[model samples]
Target: MKTYDILILGGGAAGFFTAINVAEANPRLKIAILERGKDVLTKVRISGGGRCNVTHACFDPDELVKFYPRGEKELRGPFHTFASGDTIEWFERHGVELKIEEDGRMFPVSDSSQTIIECFLEATKKCKIDVLTTQSVQSVYQGENHWKVDTNQEQFSCQKLVFATGSNPKMWELLQGLGHSIVEPVPSLFTFNIKDNRIKNLPGVSALASVNVNGTKFESAGPLLITHWGMSGPAILKLSAWGARILAQKNYQFGITVNWLHTSDAEEAEQILRDIKQNQPKKAVVSKSPFDFPNRLWESLVTASGIPSEQKWADLSKTQLQKLSTELTQSKFNVNGKSTFKEEFVTAGGIDLKEVNFKTMESKVLPNVYFSGEILNIDAITGGFNFQNAWTGAFILARSIS
Candidate 1:
């Protein structure tokens, strides 16, 4: 049996971050990370379509926590300890320069996730931490002094154990065995699926939108995309995150009201339509797109409003104008289903945060056992926020786990 002072399960972002920081905090302690997969950091490699969004530009801990749907209150104190600013400085110190885009997502200047992976691997090597791949953990039980972990290849023991396995059903079973409550995992950050003809063949059309789940209080405002399947982009993704649990309860079948203009008042949209009709009577209703919307989408909206393509703006009746205004302001679509946004499938459930000590990210019920990343019931809207959670928890766990 291999024994180490510290054992970290699942060698993804959180696991590696914890292992590296722990080794740095205590150079004498031996640390090893056991990865079930043949490769490590697969998610990081594919995140942001291989660019790997490292962290967001939000520096304030209070403002930062707002992005998270779950664990917002729990992560408040932890973020103060190791937040986005610390993340930026940490990576910069490691020779991986990060550049923040206009949308506030920070990535390696090289625009490659490999830079981040290389930095971690080099840091671990410098710290002499052992990382074992293809080490699938089967069971975990606490011994009187150290933790006992049985794996497919071998048995291992450690003075401290950390699980960053991230949404793995088998790991949740292990956590349940260890007396930790596992919040039922549900899909988050998914795009709505609609078969409405208004968006058919309008895959590339996009506009700023405010999307709200009709019955729920959940809502989001940002750029919205008319995907080949349905709707996506920041607005839809944020709504998906905020309503992950409730929508799951509804079986992914729900109604969403979309404000394509993202404005609260429809009266302003009506005025814009009237002004267009008065000023450009000779122009086709679809000719000069208003509201800064894409030309194709304006055409689609006009068609949906029953406005004839060749009809002049001057020929619009009172009913046609009202219909056009409604379509622009509050276009309702039946969200019959959902589709994956990119390849990332974020979940809004995991180890219940109430059972975790935010100060150390250690289990309140179990000693010498810690968790980070998606293994915990913490998730956020699409962006670098998810990765930031992993960094914050792992850093705290590294410092607190003696």
Candidate 2:
């Protein structure tokens, strides 16, 4: 059996990070990363639509933890130690400069994920960390003190093992056999699939809206985008992230109440309509979009209100005004399915946080076994929070092992 000091499974964001940091920390300690696929960093190449959202600009630990629906409480202390500033500085030191966007998402200034891949690849070669690809992990067992890992091609022994598999069921099963519990994994960060005429044929329409999943306590406020298939964007993505577990329990069938204007209430929306009628009485209700919504969305809303396009605001009846208010403030739509969000696939389950030590990303049930990344029950909404979790946990693990 080939023996090494440490072995990392799943050659992904966390796996490569742990390997690089550990090797750099101690030159003498041997480290190897086993990747199942022919290539490594496939997800990294495609994350953020190929730009690679490295981290969020949120420097505050408390605020950063709020983005994660799971592991928020568990990762509270971890974020304080390795927050976004630490990440920014670390990348800068490594020749990869990240720029923060207006929305606080940080990405490589070069706007290419290949920069990060090259950095990691160079780091491993410089640090003498082995990168083994096409090596599939079939089973893992703990000997008296070390781990005996069986792969498709070979078996190896390592004094320490780290798992960074993101939403991979086989890895979860392997951990389960080792006496560690695996939480039931569910999809997160998905866009809602709604078949409603109000948003149909309006693929490019978007507005500042707040969505509440009716019958559940899930609500999110942000810019919502209308697509041919359904609704998406920050608000919808946040709702999906926060309500992953609940929506899964509901079998992805639920109702969502969307406030297009994000106004206070129905009365407030009604008043806004009344003001529009009072001010722009001569203009068509569809022509004068009082809200900042796109004309397509405004026209759709007006049509859905059972009002003609040529109907002037002055000709609108009280019932039409009330119905329009309801449509703008509390438009309920049926969500029948979900679609993955552009190369970013996240899940809300993994190793139960209770069985792992968040301080070290180490498994409490196993000896010398550490974890980082999506293998754990920690996931965030959109933006760069998910990658931040992986980077934070992997950094901690590297330092702990070193």
Residue pairs with colliding backbones in model 2 are none
Clashes of each: 0, 0
**What would the per-residue lDDT of candidate 1 be over residues 355-391, giving only the tens digit for each residue?**
9988988889899898989999999998899999999
Report the C-alpha displacement of residue 83, candidate 2, in angstroms: 1.0
Candidate 2 deviation (Cα RMSD): 0.9
Residue pairs clashing in model 1 are none
Give per-residue CA lDDT, model 2, range 1-402, as digits (tens): 789999999888889988988888888999999999999999999998889999999999999998899989988999999989999998898999999899999999999999999999999999989999999999898898899999999999999999987889988998898898998999999999999888888997889999999987889999999998999999999999999999999999999999988856889999989998998889989885778888888889889999998999999999999999999889999999999988788989999999999888889999899998999988998888888998899999999998
Question: How much does each candidate deviate from the true structure in C-alpha RMSD?
Answer: 1.0, 0.9
Query: What lDDT would candidate 2 get against the real structure?
Result: 0.91
Query: What value does the lDDT take at residue 76 in candidate 1?
Result: 92
Q: Least lDDT summed over 10 consecutive residues: which range in candidate 1?
A: 258-267
